[model samples]
Target: MSRVFEKRYALSRRALLRSVGGLGALTAMPLLSHEAFAQPVFRVYPFQLGVAAGDPQPDGFVIWTRLAPEPLDLGYGMPSEPVEVKWEVAADAGFRTVARSGTAVARPELGHSVHVEVAGLEPARPYWYRFTAGKERSLYGRARTTPLAGTDLQRVRFGVAGCQHYEQGYFTAYRKLAAEPDLDFVFCYGDYIYEYRGERLANGGTGPIETIRQHNEGEIYSLDDYRRRYAQYKMDADLQAAHAAAAWFTTWDDHEIDNNWVGDIDQDGTPAEVFRLRRQAAAQAYFENMPLRARSFPIGPSVQLYRRASYGRLLDLNLLDTRQYRTDQPCGDEWAATCAGVAAREAQVLGAAQEKWLLDSLSGSRARWKVLAQQIMMMDLDRAPGKAVGYNLDSWAGYAQPRDRLLRQIRDRRIENAIVITGDEHQNFAGELHLTGATPGPRPIASEFVVTSISSGGNGQDQRPDMIEIQRANPQLKFNNAQRGYMICDVTPERWESEFKVLDKVSDREGALSTRTKLAVAADDARVVSA
Candidate 1:
């Protein structure tokens, strides 16, 4: 069966607010007529999922949204029809006077996603924005630019979250994060969407626990499959609310396609060439659904996912790409010398281009703090100290050479106040990073705070005995908690504090949230102190 016809797909009632009469038909709809346009029934796009602004510079930030009207193809098909989208940024919530306003068009070729890179704005100031298409308008989204160079920012609060498996539970975590009005923005560290065909639980189940759309009848190996999955995930209300609540900076990890997939390797060691078409499809869908700049658009099986963002004089965040340019998975006994060899100098995690970019950016950065916004833990997370190896070899530990080199650069160049915010493992961890083999041997060079997952594995799972033993052996690891929640990081000129907030219960949809732990790093020292 054809991909499109695999399911009797129909746009939801909420998606039909904007008629399918093309731009002309939109005007004819009672809700989109001239009078309606004058007083538009401003409703956010349901499947646009989330609204986010990112890559904030002194001048501007990119605002994004996807149009999901009926006859779904009308919004993403070729010919690239122009759909007028009006956007405004304001100092206040009511939009009494606009700070910035412009007209943009959502082109069909890019899945009708609109990316408005607004400029001519003041730095270190908060702004509220919204978008309108015909009679349909998105919710007000908040974003801000980095402060001016050398300006003292007393505080910067941001939310960190990842691994939101839609079927596991509702995006209640996001709902709570959105309610926190003090947040400047959100940092999503990958696994935003899982590519599994259905929920695979410890107890055998053949379908998703909860889903907006049916899963792919089989494994997703096509662009259409990925696109449809994105659409399904976006239909979640909580995810949409969070996106509307704040601007987001994002990166992707393995589940965006398959677990542990690097470059083009299959579970059976099949070359990426065999799955080239599927990989291309996944990359394209990822680009269409993300609030990424044009430069990161997918060309084929690859997309440039690494870049830098500045937060005024306070911080420079370098988001890394650990998937695309990585070496193959390691081989040998889980904890043997053979496995360690796989992490040799030839092994790579950041790829050549990304490594050079990261090194140069870190060395040249003038911000008070250099933040590495990466997908996995940067600290050494050996499941077993000297004997047992970790279960997964796709993380930084697997690319030991690249990890050491990056840490060496930070130490050699005297990159002060370096910090890494990461996500991926379904656990929260706080650690002080030390460059073991550098000239300044075994000295603390950076700090890393890893956020837990959203709803991948519930919070009630029994603790793993191996992990418990591993923690007892690794003194560098300050804190560890297996839970379902997010992290909140507050940065300032004097200190950066992080709180590991966990949901009271992931088994229940309306769970409460509490702080699992807290860690702080002082600007004068690169060490992590308990808060």
Candidate 2:
């Protein structure tokens, strides 16, 4: 049958689906032919990979799901046909009162994934949602719209985490995060899954990181590999629980496509054309797996990820896309370089366009807190302890000109309460952003808290020796912790506070999560203060 005919093969319920009651009444709809509503050629639950929702506005949010019956199979054990998926949002979990409901086509071309943007609902209210594909019902998900864009709000809470390597350990930190009922949303800062082909990595210098599970086989070059990998991660109960507990806001760094990849360039040195194909495949899988809004829908290796999420009058979040527009690491990734190559002014992280967008957003924001939810460490951390300093070129420290430009804009524009939430260092840090990049006694233009990874590295210590050295050399630094877990931010009208929540260990499931330290920055002041 033709593509259009195959689409028409679905149960005829256009008029029935326009009403809320018709959604639940769809249980009896059947395929006209055996090939109409195709199923995987195996015994597996279609919703094994789980469901999620993200990018919530005051009126709506996006709900996501993929039909992966046999998750690891080359075809993800899903038939090569479109399936009808119905989603209903209710004010309560019991489905007694449906607020908004709709049906979406889970197409084979998009890996059988569904993204339904539920709209016209009440603002700042909690809603429960679930999907039904044929007879299989997905786990219900909890989501909330942001407060009306201009409402005078007092407080908001959220958790930030990323860099979860599947083999490193279990997602116990996510379990801890899922239990936090007060969180408005979760901010995932890149490296959600590693693309390595099961290469054994030493967790830290010389020490072997304990493994809980390993990757399927080789490096993921095709769509199937990435899909299988994502399905494997979603199958974890902790991650699923996290998704079920609240909505999520996410952005990608190096590992989503390839390590240290900038723009169209892949780190493995594949030709740009071939790498673009790989990138497109990776993006397809990412969109298939992530609970992102339609604005970030992938199209031939590109996706518009940088957008604003406003939460009433209390906060406006400018989620950035660091990897997509960044310059390749000046002196190669993950190394210290003091050469002139690092000093060149042409290096751009946000490209020219996104930088403008950010500055404009910052200037126009009327909220009490302006938060930049981005990836990477923004401080100029010196790796060398002497007069001639060496810096890591992989982070914002490498793109000094742009970093300085951004800080200057923050200062010149007088952006108040400009707080940056970050990750990808695998270690916690509380620091200030200074124009001169001198840590000691320099008044900060802005403040940032770099949240660590969930399980990217193995268990870490309370502090690293080099961090102490760096701290001594730089006084703007306030707190540092090397551990596995997430960071929680409490944003109020008058002040913003962050708790460095830590897991004692990720190498084993027994590690307890604790608040290692707390820090605060007043709304009027740009300096980080210990709470």
- Candidate 1, 91-175: lDDT as tens digits: 8889987988865555555566767767789987778888876565677878777767677667788999999876666677888
Encode model 2's per-residue lDDT on 314-428: one tens digit a residue: 9999999998888778766657566666667998999999999999999999999999999988888787776567787888888888989999899888887899888988999
Q: Count clashes in each candidate, considering only residues at least 3 apart in sequence or on different chains.
A: 2, 0
lDDT (CA) per prediction = 0.71, 0.82
Alpha-carbon RMSD, each predicted model: 7.0, 4.9
Model 1 residue 187 CA deviation in Å: 1.0
lDDT of 1 at 304: 81
| TM-score of candidate 1 relative to the true fold | 0.84
Best by TM-score: 2
Give the number of the best model, judged by lDDT.
2
